[model samples]
Target chain A: MTNETETEQTPEHVPMMQQILDNPFLLLFLGVTIPTVLYILWGVMEVASIPLAD
Target chain B: MTAETVVGVGRRAAAADFRTCPYTGLKVDAAAQTLIKANAVAAVVFLLIGGLMGLLVALTRWPAVHLLPADWFYLVLTGHGANVLLFWIIFFEIAVLYFASAVLLNCRLPAPKFAWLGFALMVVGAIITNVVVLQGESSVMFTSYPPMMAKPNFYLGLILFAVGALIGCAIFFATLAIAKQERTYEGSIPLVTFGALTAAIIAVFTIASGAIILIPTWLWSLGLIGEIDPLMYKVVWWAMGHSSQQINVSAHVSIWYMVGALLLGAKPLSEKVSRTAFFLYILFLQLASAHHLLAEPGLTASWKIVNTSYMMYLAVLGSMIHGLTVPGSIEAAQRKNGYDKGVFEWLRKAPWGNPAFAGMFLSLVMFGFIGGISGVVLGTEQLNVLMHNTIYVPGHFHGTVVTGTTLAFMAGTYLVLPLIFQREIVWPKLAKIQPYLFGIGAAGISLFMMGAGTLGVARRHWDITFSDAELSFAHSAGAFLMMGLNGVFAILAALGGAIYVLVVVGTVLFGKKITAGHKLTFPLHAGGGAAVSQYGSHATTKLPGTIVLVAIFFVCFVLYYFINWKYLSELWLFR
Candidate 1:
């Protein structure tokens, strides 16, 4: 994934997400993060729907 | 080179490459290092989440500060149990397996890709389970008992995790085989690796039991199966549940020895005796699962007696042997280094400033004194009935799992960061004090919980005050005080845990890196090579200090064991 030609051709700074994706450890974090965010959203929705008892 | 030769060449190149620790001179394969890092990182993350949940649970139990609502209390309790008990520990155990097998044996990992697959499955499964638990439909509180059902994904997630762990176990075995075939080290494996081998073997049995039970539970959750017998489910489930802690006992005991060696350059006092103890664990440890089912009416007395008395004693004997030999080994090593004055001189001369040594020694003492002794008492059929579903059960496990296993893992991480990751530990001052802070707080938590349990605090109930119940019951005021103190100690322990996390994460992310072949400047493990595996000569160099400690342990164990019996006797007098 580390390409010498590509680096030489594009000598500008890369985006932060691209840098994170390049690192395997950071990718592992991302793998867990997506599902966690979705789960949190789902949890918020579920709790919102619960009606208060009289 | 051709494509075939290119692949072959890469394989050969990686296999030929190894890095030797400048301090210990042990060879570490690159791929094994990757797996260890991945697993250890995941373990610490779970520890953070679990510790937070535990703090909430403790505060909720406090009478003066009933924190979370009942629903949230049960939910957080369930998450705490799953993350800390299963996820945090097993992830670290996988790391330990890789380190003990491939790194210790000086062999390359046989299937690095397959190992990654296992890691991915485990990560996915753990996330799935956490997600489901947070969804609030799966707060069955770790046990997920038959009559109370959780989402099917909860059971499915657990099954996937178990299968992933089974794959990791298989890789450990295969790595061992590769070491043997390649003749990496002569004779039998090292004692620490042997201990890890015991844990892995027990893991195989434990995971098999989990699969056997969780598979059906998954089906039942999906409505594919009829009613599951609650008693039958409990019997088989504990075979998975309690036996999993048996895996923890084996792994952390192994870490005790490993950290002893890394810190003090200590060897097992008698390598043969220690290895035999590990062997004893593999043979009889799973039978200790009977303690969880001791109060179940469905199980026959004969069955209970055989497991708790006949076989479980052997498991306890195994732990007793480890309790003696680990500190005995440290004392023997210290004496050999000419600290040969009085009984406590070797102990006094030990490198207590080193966090690794301090954490390990505290773990050993607390584990043997409180955890081991209380565990045996709680395991007894007669005494167990008094405190079966009470707060005492969690008290006993917190002593073992948190104080014993988690502390050992934390101690092991100190050395691991410097040695394996080649990072100079940041926050050295805080690192030095972290162990004691954690140890004192965790010990306080355990003692107060046990005290509360003794005064009739219910285990799973969120409110100690029976304000909502029709038939109200009142516990002693001391129990409320104990719960309050438990909350304070839990906060202290969480602070300690946070300090550890900051020190480790900060060091790994930004600390000075040691180049390959450069000697590490860390003062941990500053002793000479004279103590590394010093076997067969001056084996028993007058460890009166360890003898006294062991004697103290036994005396305390006897007192506690009988006190429980006395309490049981007072319940119904024949007079």
Candidate 2:
């Protein structure tokens, strides 16, 4: 029963790349800003990228 | 009683003033007990303040019902971190240092006046810091990284507190030397005292680092100095910041063994092994501070990789050794008492009703499983980016510092009230349940916050929802659920903390007094010196039940470790 539960929890054969792209931020970082420093607050998009109150 | 009386007399004659605990057979100095009481009372007051601030912070993080305004939330967060992390824990540690040296070794406290001076400075500093934070405008969180500055008084308050703690450490060392000259215990010092000594040494290093960074920053805040480099500030500051928690680790691990000895008549499975682990902590543990700077740009990849990978694992090894031997010792003792049926019959029969045992055992398990495993994960260079500056960071520390250290300290206090204060515990039923309530609730808060952080919620943001931001980001349904649940558990933990405060305060003020030489009718088991052995002649050495538990822990650790690696790998296509 324990072995079966372990097997069930482990991811079965979905492509790892597909899993990575599920988070939109990672996809944006890899596709657009791979060479640049990926600082969201330093002006990629207009407005405060970070929720930090100045 | 008088200063002249204590000063002129030979050290052996000073023993005339000491009274022996009838239960534990350890001599207690009256001055040490008074200092312990004062520090403990102060520690609980700060816990109440910090715990209330924590509840408000938790509620504000809950997206569906954000409680505090952004300004108020930041202010409270600053107060919460300072009081709980710095003031509460350090005050209690000074008390522990005195107890381990003077009381356990059965000697007079050298320079009682210096101890009182340290206590007065600490009390004044804690009050000043709190007052300045509440006065509004110093919302720079615990890491008051300048470019952003708090009031000059905020910096001054911290410096004063550190100097006071340094004095306490000096007194602890002097007492140890006096104990040696006076010939208190034979062979080496007790393992608990050795652990405390390790903490004191680390604290001195930590306090010096703080003084180096904070003094210049204080001048900058006063506009007497020009510029404070942010990177330079962070590098020096975490030497104190991270090592402060390391102090907690040593002290609480000592208490783990103490509670075990008190409750189960346990001994360290091997005193040499246990002492060696503490030695490793002294040598390599503070190197783990480099993990805080891993994602910073100023440091090189080689520096980060070496510090986080090789040297950091040595520190990890020290903790892992402690994790195994502490419970293993208890299991070995129980088996000797003839509970050696199945793998866990000894564990099953162990005293669940004793609040001290229950709190310490729960602290050990939660710390190992939640704090230890998560700490190793977050320290990894590649994996840290995913959780860095997220609620996961707070989640991880609350596991270590709150559930682990604070819970263990609370457990130690249960023994202290009866043992030192000569007072019976008030509301015995509430005291018994307090650990479970706090531990379980704290565990929930940790797990749920980590869950939210995994789903990419920000830390230190007043609102997780991006409600005030121009670009509003929507978090996953799971993140919302996790945060809402975190709020619920925070309330539960606060209730548990309230029970502790009420019980401790009521008992200290008005409970029935047990005269120091008499036996108690409460939770602490009535056991003499044989019951509190750190080593033994009995050789029934197998700890199969503890071995099984250790195996289960390793399984959980391995699975969680790999899962984080997989998460990191997904963040980059090549790496």
Candidate 3:
């Protein structure tokens, strides 16, 4: 809740968790980037470095 | 002044192309509504085609039946995998994404024309792929591994489909921004919308992966390149192929929560906990793609262990959280309604008659017990070695994708008709029983297929009998019996699917209109979500029933894991 709605009396108050939750862009960025690094990028690196079969 | 009355598009309904739902009071936009309807209708049409193809494939796999010829079997199997797994599911998901952002948030959809273009591209792409598969030249199966090349159009179809999906994800994100900037709802988005956000984020990653691999493969198919490395294609393709399962989970989990919320007035046991789980859910599910590559010698031991074994469990844990919380919240709400006699009274008194509840619960249970637990075993590098090419692999995915994800979507449609389409559902009796019929049948298909696979039935063979070969060998009698049972279950599941299509399509076409003050055919729980529906008190609600259910799940998981290891040891010891 914000002063616009102003349910709580705490001035300019929004929990850090609430702020993060409200930010869809930030969530999308982290969600896409994290998985890419851990899964796709990591797997690509390994595949790129695969030595020729003996 | 109630939270429920703060409509999304209805906020500015005087000027915009928005209408308020007579039942739920959410502001619905005409553009969003049309998009949702088109995508959903397309999804169902694909489902009908794909499901029939699956039935043919299953009958062909059953030696006693062997419905299709070898070439036709491979062709239908290819179409089945792509249609049901890719097209049907993604189309429905795009609909959900639109609904969650635009309707739930009470915001207008941005760039409606572009969204239509995206949908057209997807439909066109799906048609092209299906046409190519039907042409008898490109039966590479769903994975489409290299050297076994398909026509360039096949890969091109998939790439276009991926691009369309990416656009859909973008529209969802854009809708979210419009909602926030315009101040549709206060504080954080609803938990259902948050879950949708998780799914769309994953969709982007999954589609991007498809683009990365499929574009090159498309060129190779055209002879623009000499060849694609088998190992490289295998690894990257699994990223595109297997990781899409995560998209299904994320989307269907959103559906579960949405269904639970709408039908049963169920809220999560802990909002923060469940959202955290969704965060962990998508993050780790991508890592679980490593299981597909576990058998590849080119990938090392340490890589498989860290990614497949350790990190994959995080995905399992996320699902486990959802599995527990969904029912826990439901139980809490049920008990709140004065069904609080004992541990199981809430469970016993649930709306088992409602297709939505029944389907959602069945999906959650099947996904967790049969799908998730077995997945844990198969995702292990050592266990994967035993199960990799066996029919058990199909069995496991059948459990997840079919019973888990597909059933969830099927159940959600019961509600989708009235809410989105604003039409009454016909055939109340059939609607009541469709979930059980489909669920039991599909679960049987998964379990029996797994049973045969465990006995070392080959996964990728049109003929296990080898009737044409010079030398004929036979699997154990038990393997044959399990497959025979699989055929039977496929028939039952197909029956249920037909009923679903009839009821949904029939209702939308001819059922009574849901105008303002219309009597809703299937009654919703009166009032808003069981917002404060926690048991005991708000702080430390005790979910005794859910806790007991989860304990049983853990016991089953541990027992199954050890059993696989013991089975592995027996092979070596006996030989």
TM-score of chain B of each: 0.95, 0.96, 0.96
**Tens digits of per-residue lDDT for model 3 on B169-274?**
9999998877766767655677788888888888887898899889999999988988798877777777778878888998889888878777666766777788
Q: Please provide, for model 1 over B1-575, each residue's C-alpha lDDT reduced to its tens digit, 9 standing for 90 to 100.
A: 00000001122335556877777666678889989999999999999999999999999998888999999999999999999999999999999999988877777888988998998889989999999999997899989897999999999889989988989988998887777667665445666777788788778777877887799989999989987767666766776798788888888898888877767677778766786687667667777777787776556676677767787888899899988899898888777777879889889888887888888889988888878888898889998878778887788888898899999999989878987788988888999999999998899898898888888888989898888999989888898899999999999999999999899899889978877665554453544222332222226746789889889888898898888889999995788
**Candidate 1 off by > 4 Å:** A1-54, B1-16, B516-538
- With candidate 2 superimposed using the best TM-score fit, by how many Å does residue B345's alpha carbon deviate from the native? 1.5
What DockQ does each listed candidate score? 0.01, 0.01, 0.47
Indicate which candidate wins on TM-score.
3
Q: Interface RMSD values for the candidates, listed in order?
A: 17.8, 20.7, 3.0
How many clashes show up in model 2?
0
**Candidate 2 residue lDDT tens string, B261-372:** 7777777787667777876677667667778887886566666666667867887898999998998888987887778899899899888877888899999999999999
Please give fnat for model 1.
0.00
> Where does candidate 1 chain B have its weakest 10-residue lDDT segment?
B1-10
Each model's lDDT comes to 0.79, 0.80, 0.84
List the pairs of residues colliding in candidate 1. none
Native-vs-model 2 lDDT?
Answer: 0.80
- Model 3: lDDT equals 0.84
Point out the higher-scoring one by TM-score: 2 or 3: 3
